[model samples]
Target: MQGNKSEHTIQKEIQLALSKHKCSVFRTNVGKVKTIDHRWFDTGLPQGFPDLMGYRWVDNQIFFIEVKSQTGKSRPDQLIFHEFLQSHNVIHGIARNVKDALMIVDGGLCGFGYD
Candidate 1:
C-alpha cells in the first residue's frame, strides 16, 4: 500500500484518521526562503523537524511523525533530530503509511510512560 502513495497523500490520510479519533494534528513545512534582498532564512524550526505534530487527548501525550514515501529516506539532520527526540523521551517516528503514523500517535510504539 505504501509503495504507491506520495508522502503528501499518506500524510493527509494520517491527519484525517487522527482527526477522526479526536486528536489535533498539524503539518510542518521546513525549508529556507529567499527574501527580496536575496537573503535566505529558515522556516524557524530546527532542521529535521517532523512533518506532523499533534496532541492525543486520551493519553495527554504529544507526538511527532516524519512522513516518507516508500522509497524515501531521511536525511542526516532528520536522523539526528529523531535521535534527539528519543533521548528526550519525546514521542516521534517515521511513518511511510497511515498505519505507521496512527501507531505512533496511538502510542502503540515509541511511547514512554510518565509518572
Candidate 2:
C-alpha cells in the first residue's frame, strides 16, 4: 500500500510537470493565451461525455478523458466507455482526477502520466 501511494504521488508530479510544459508550448505556438477548459459533447442519449476533451489543433485530432478523483465515483456511461476503449485498444480517458489531469499527449495517443 505504501509503495503504491508513493508511486501515485510520483506519477502525479510528473504529470503536472508535463502538462504545464505542454500547455506553455502550445499556447506559444497558437499565439494565444488562456487555454479553454473542457469541451463537452451532448449526445442527448440519456447520458453524455464531458469531463474533458482536448483538440489537437495541428493534427485536427481529439483526445478525451473522463477524470474522477476516485475510481469508483465514475459515471456509468464513463465506465462503459472506459471498458470499450480498453477492449478496442483505443484511447479515451476516465476524464481526470482533478481540475488538472496530468497526461502526456503524443500522436493522438496519451501516456497516462508520462510512462
Candidate 3:
C-alpha cells in the first residue's frame, strides 16, 4: 500500500541521516540464507535485532534504533530486543521517521536533515 512505501522511504532517509552523523552509526540488513535442509531461511541476524545499531562517542552511549514507517508496527522479536536492551542498560527505541531518529541521535538538537 501507499503507506508501506512511504514508510520505507522514510526509513531510507533515516539511514542516510544516520550515516552522516559525526558519531558511529550502522544499519542492519537481515538476509535470507540456505538451511541445512536446502531451503532458504531468514537466519542471518538474530530475530528482532534493531534496524540500526551504533555508538555515540559524545555521551559514550550505545544506541539501538528500530526504524519503522509512521504506521508500522514492531515485530515480537523487536519488542523482546528492546526489553533486553533496557534490561542491559543500553539505549534503544523505535523510530518512525527521520525526525524521530534525529531525536534518538542527539535529542533533535543537532539538526539532522532528511534531504
Candidate 4:
C-alpha cells in the first residue's frame, strides 16, 4: 500500500488524518509561480522546505513534514534543511505515508520527545 502511493496521495491522506487528530495543517507549495503574462516568480520559501506545515493545539507545538512516496528520496537541500530544523529543536520529518506522518506529528519516531 505504501510503495504504490504517489506523493500527492500520501500528502492528502496525511492531511486528512492530521485534521481528524485536531491538528491544523496545510500544504506548502515551494516553487515558481506562473503569472498570466507567462512570467515565473519564486514562492519566496527557501528550497527544500517541507511539504506540509502545521501546529498541534494540544501542546501548541509546530511541525513540518516532507511527504514522499515509499521509494522517494529527499534531495540534498532537503536533508540539509531537515538538519537545520533539528539543530533548532524543531519538529520535522520526511513522511512516506500517513502512518509515518502521524508518528512524526505525534513525536513518536523522529526523536522529538514523545515516548
Candidate 5:
C-alpha cells in the first residue's frame, strides 16, 4: 500500500502471511503474469495475470488475488479478472495492505466480484 508492488512483491507478502499460519503459497511466474495479464475476450481479448495464488491450510480453499495500492489506476486486465473471479466465485481484488489481503480471505470482500 505504501510502495509500488509488482506481482512478485505481492506474492512475497502472501508468502510471508501464509508462513505465519503455516500455509503453503503458490506464486505466479512472470510468464504467467505476462500471458494472462487481462481478460482478452471480455467483449475484448484477455491478457493479464493474478498476483498470487494459494490454498489456505485452515480452510483448504484456493485464492486468486491481484494486489494494488490504496489509490491509483488499476490495470485493464485486472478489471477483466475481477469479473471473471466474481462469476467464478474465486478470490480477486485490489488490496492496499497485508490487512487488506487477509480480508480477502476472511470474506471481508463481497459484491466486488470475488468469493
Candidate 6:
C-alpha cells in the first residue's frame, strides 16, 4: 500500500518554499522552557498555534499555517484557534502539503485541505 508523506517532511518543504519565495517565516516551538538559573519561561501560549508563521512580502500579509499530511486532519483545538483567528481577521489556514501551503502564502486561503 502506498503511504502518505510524513508531516515532518511536508512541514520542511513548506518552510523551505516560503523562505525561497522571500517570505519571512518561522516555526512555532511549543513546550516548556527552564533556564539554568531556574527561571521558568512560559508565555502561556494558547493551544493550536499554527506550525508556521510568516509575513508574505508581496502583499505585506501575515499568516499562520497548520501543516498536515495527506491523511491528516486538524484537531479540535486547532479548529477553535482557527475560528479565533478568523474572528480577529488574522490570516490562517491548514496546509496538507507544499502546494496547499504555498497557496496559503499566496492568498491565505485554505482551498482543498480546510474543512
lDDT of each candidate versus the true structure: 0.82, 0.42, 0.69, 0.82, 0.60, 0.79
Among these predictions, the greatest lDDT belongs to 4
In model 4, where is the ten-residue run with the lowest total lDDT?
Answer: 106-115
Ranking by TM-score: 4, 1, 6, 3, 5, 2
Model 4, span 31-60: residue lDDT tens:
898899999999999998989999998987
The residue-by-residue lDDT of candidate 5 on 1-115, one tens digit each, is 4576664565577668865764566656433222365743232224556666676777777776666554445667666667777777775565556766677776635324233
Off-target runs (Cα >4 Å) in candidate 6 are: 1-3, 32-43, 110-112
Which segments of model 1 are wrong by more than 4 Å? 111-115
- Candidate 5 lDDT (Cα, whole model)? 0.60
Task: Score residue 102 of candidate 2 by CA lDDT.
Answer: 40
Q: State model 2's lDDT.
A: 0.42
TM-score of 1: 0.87
lDDT of 3 by residue, 41-86 (tens): 8757888888787777777677778777766777777777676776
Best by TM-score: 4
Stretches of candidate 2 above 4 Å error? 1-48, 70-72, 86-90, 95-104, 107-115
RMSD of each candidate? 4.2, 10.6, 5.8, 3.3, 6.6, 2.9
Per-residue lDDT tens digits for candidate 1, residues 1-115, read 5499998999999999988987999999899999999999889999999889998888778888888888888888888888788887888888887778777777645622210
lDDT of 6 by residue, 62-113 (tens): 9898888778888888888888888877877888777777877776663335
The global Cα lDDT (0 to 1) of model 6 is: 0.79
**For model 5, the run of ten residues with the poorest summed lDDT:** 39-48
TM-score of each: 0.87, 0.40, 0.72, 0.89, 0.65, 0.80
Q: Give the count of colliding residue pairs in each prediction.
A: 0, 7, 0, 0, 15, 0
lDDT rank order = 4, 1, 6, 3, 5, 2
